[model samples]
Target: MQSRRKLRFRLIVSFALFGFGLSALFAFAALNIRTRVEDQLVNASLMDDAKWANQQAREHPGAPSGSRLLTGTVLSDRTLYKAPLTWQSLENGVHDIFEPGPDGEEHHYKLAVYREGGIISFLQYDVSREELGKQQLLFSVIGAVFLFGLLSLAIGLWLSRKVLKPVSELANRLRDFRKAGKAEPLAPHFADDEVGELAHALDEYSARLTAMVERDREFNSDVSHELRTPLAVIASTTELLQGSPDLTEKLSERLKRIERASRQATELIEALLLLSRAERRGPTRGETTEVGKVAADVIESQRPQMRGKPLSIELAVNAPVSVNAPASVLSVALTNLIGNAIKYTLEGSVRVEVGDGRIEVIDTGPGIKPEDAERLFQRGVRGEGAGGSGAGLGLAIVRRLCELYGWDVSMRPRTDANGAIASIRFS
Candidate 1:
């Protein structure tokens, strides 16, 4: 594909070629006019010379009373003329005279002499006026060609810009839609050309894309709703098994494991449901919610999960750090991030820092490898240190929620610390 600069250069070259073609046509017309004018002048000069020769023949005495012709020549120097000569050996029709003048000037003349009786006559005429007029015409043609060429160049530029304006606007709109991840359709302008066809096509494409996205959102929401029932039954069954008293010690231990697995599965299902909901809820409805308050609530709610673990919690939120997003969605996202930090950290603390339009969750567990950072938020991909206890959907859900709220998320190894730090910045 050609770059924009190359395309523009080609457009300019095309206009230049068009202008050159027009100039060539004008030059051809001028040349034709000059040739016709020269031909007419030559014919007129010949006729005038013939008339003078006939008149002189009538006035001349019967030197032979035959059709003898006298001819004269005018040279290139206007004041020079050759002596008249009677030619008896000439043909009876027309004859030409070539001679030198007084100043060695050279000229040519055609003489036509005829007679019924013996007669001699001469005709002298100058052909310089025709030559001079031809020179003037040639010079005028050259000047007009140059002037028209410049005029065509200017007009060509204006015409090119006028033709390319709609194309440029379409390109700009496509670029903006790609970068912003949403389309703003251009206002319609009607024309009976290819540009009009292109505009109609683009409008149809944007409409189809918008419809497809809306359908996908609706499908996700429906799927999430359908899965919730089964998840809830599994959670209730596991809880009932853990609470039953008829179980043996070993079986009770197994039941406790089942309960834990069921709880984790329930949390994973709930996270998926929340993620689907977040995706469907567009950004326009987000409200200002305090990040620090959400952080504190998540930490308090998850305190029971960290009962026997030697993990510390640190909150460094000083000022009111708020974000324009759904409070419930933000709470779920932050809870997942903090929970992942705690689950990954073996012994050290999990730190939650909140600032204006920013949140950071850092853990002092074994840091994630550089290669794994890219897929950390991808579904079903977990760090090497994450055991079978995690469903690997927590970070994915967090990332999805952040995206829905127009937030940027970055995860990397904490260089100054010992574990990974997940940062979220609100837009």
Candidate 2:
């Protein structure tokens, strides 16, 4: 079977991903806005510095030392003022560039250039401190993004658990209901939401299922009770008819068959009733019966069926075996085992072995199919090679009876003999 991912894990991952995406989007927006605002502020500061320098240079044209300006005559091809290597690249406008300061520290500068009377003037404004502040703003935004992402992840986890707690509790309650055969009210503790609706639905389903189970048990009990009355009457009437002595041989045989059939029917009814009772109230204690005697009686009762075929049924007792179970249950289970043996075997004998707390029926019939062994005792299931006129309920009934009395039953193909062995071990 393919494994499934848990709902809680999916919920957590989905919420976490949503949080991460939202955090990344906000961080990107913040970084873009901070970059734009810092650029505008730097441009304004550089323009103000350029205007101030121009005013100073105009006021004191000859003494240019008071103002931070480099004035040079570009009419001749010679250097006239202190300039960097790339100073020629400056145009007649403000430009931001990087240059080395006196201490060799990297500095950001705004270079403003103007030309008049064959002379070129350049104004340089140091903006490295403002650049450092911009860098700090970038770092702070990055740090905020990281922190917010973590916070979002934490919040997602918390919310996911809060949302999935009711689901987990419902699962646990359902498990408890299965074990104890009862369901507790779930909507009382949860809020009025989707989870609460689900719990309420489950409560309704549980009620319906419990009612169906109760009705089924009652139906089976009532049917079994109704069946016993007629079966008892038939058994008593058959006994009375069998006691009559003025009958012919043919009539006597027919009556004997009727008596056997009636007794078998009555025993089946009793077994069914016992099985039904066991279902409702569990296994009940009964008389301790000798396993050997039970096996002998089963064989004797099956003798009539074996007469037509070349089959012999024998019972052997290794030790005085006994079990605490109803006599009818033991009889029905053994009868079904021996009957199957007799019905399937064409020419070989069927042996019944009784030991302490154990009974085994070894039949010289066609060995059971390996595939059928797994569900051999399931109701209405017949093996592929089972050549019989049965509805396949005998072994099922035997299984139910064994379960009722705390007995273990198993069936397997015999290795030494071309047949099968069915065993019941009592505890």
Candidate 3:
């Protein structure tokens, strides 16, 4: 497609070429008219001189007649009659007999003679009206071209803008429709040409995409619902086995590990379901939830999991902070960050800091490498030196929930002598 600048340039060039051709034609006609006028002037002058000379010679026989004397004197001037008369000269003069005579190309003359007591004289002069007419014609053509070109250009630009306005509006509407996860309908302007046809096709495509997304969402929801009952039964049976007294130490340890793994799988499945919900719609409707309270609750719930670890957990919540967000989503995200911090730091401490609309989880574990930091929150991607047996969905879930709630998440090396810090900023 041609850009606006290129289209304007093409139109200007076309108009200029057309104007130049017209100007050239006018100039040619003007030159032809001038040539014809010069020839007629020359012929008439010669005829008048001949008649005057003959009348003078018939009236006066001895002394030279006034007309004869005048003609002879004029022709004798070498500067005035530069070229001698020849066949070539006569033919050239006759061709333009109705056109402006040439000045430098050929010299014109007046001649007089007496024959049978009759004085005959011939006179010639060049006409220059053709050159003046050419000038006038050129000026008129130029003025007309400028006036018409400007008017046409103005009208063309106006029409182009009017015609393209509908397309521009439709583009903006389609962008909004996509962002809202809705189907875009054909724009009203799509009632005519190829652009209109394209708009209709886009509307059809968007409808299909919306339907496919809806189906995928329903499928994810159904699967999540079906798995909940089985997972709940398994969790309950594992708890029962752990409480029994007949188990040997080795068997008990193995069963405990299985129970932990099963619990982790259940948590991961729940996170996946939440993510699917967030993707299909958006963040859950927000309520005024106390951030500090949520943080304290998550810490208390996960305390048992850190019992034998050679690490300390610290909570440094300053002022009471509140935010409008889903309480469960925020709690889940904070729990994952704190868990990772505890799992990674072997012999140091993990700190959870809560402030105005913000939470930071810092751990004294081996700090993340620069390359690893970039992909830390990506699903199924574990950083080097991360704890073994981690599902790697913790940070991924945190990142997705933050997006759904319009929060910001960032990670950096902690300044305090040990690990990495993950920060979440709520808007």
What's the lDDT for all of these models? 0.69, 0.75, 0.66
lDDT of 1 by residue, 1-427 (tens): 9556655556667777676777778877877887778657655555456555555445653322222223442221222233243544454445556666556888655555333334333344445555677678778777776777777677767776887878887788789889998777554654757876887888888899789878978886777667767767876887787788787888876666665555555555555665654543422455577889878877866665676789899899856777766566777787788887887787879989988768999999888888888798899877777444676877887888777768888889988978999888878
Across residues 225-262, which tens digit of lDDT does each residue of candidate 3 receive? 78877877877887898889897888777766666556
Cα TM-score per model:
0.49, 0.66, 0.58
TM-score: the better of candidates 1 and 3? 3
Which pairs, if any, clash in model 2? none
By TM-score, the candidates rank as: 2, 3, 1
Worst lDDT run of 10 residues, candidate 1, spans: 74-83
Error of 2 at 322 (Å): 3.8
Q: In TM-score terms, which candidate is top?
A: 2
Model 3, poorest ten-residue lDDT window?
A: 87-96
Model 1 spans with C-alpha error above 4 angstroms: 1-13, 17-148, 154-211, 227-290, 300-310, 314-317, 355-357, 368-384, 388-396, 406-408
Evaluate model 3: give its TM-score: 0.58
lDDT for position 378 in model 1:
96
- Residue 142 in model 2: shift from native, Å? 6.4
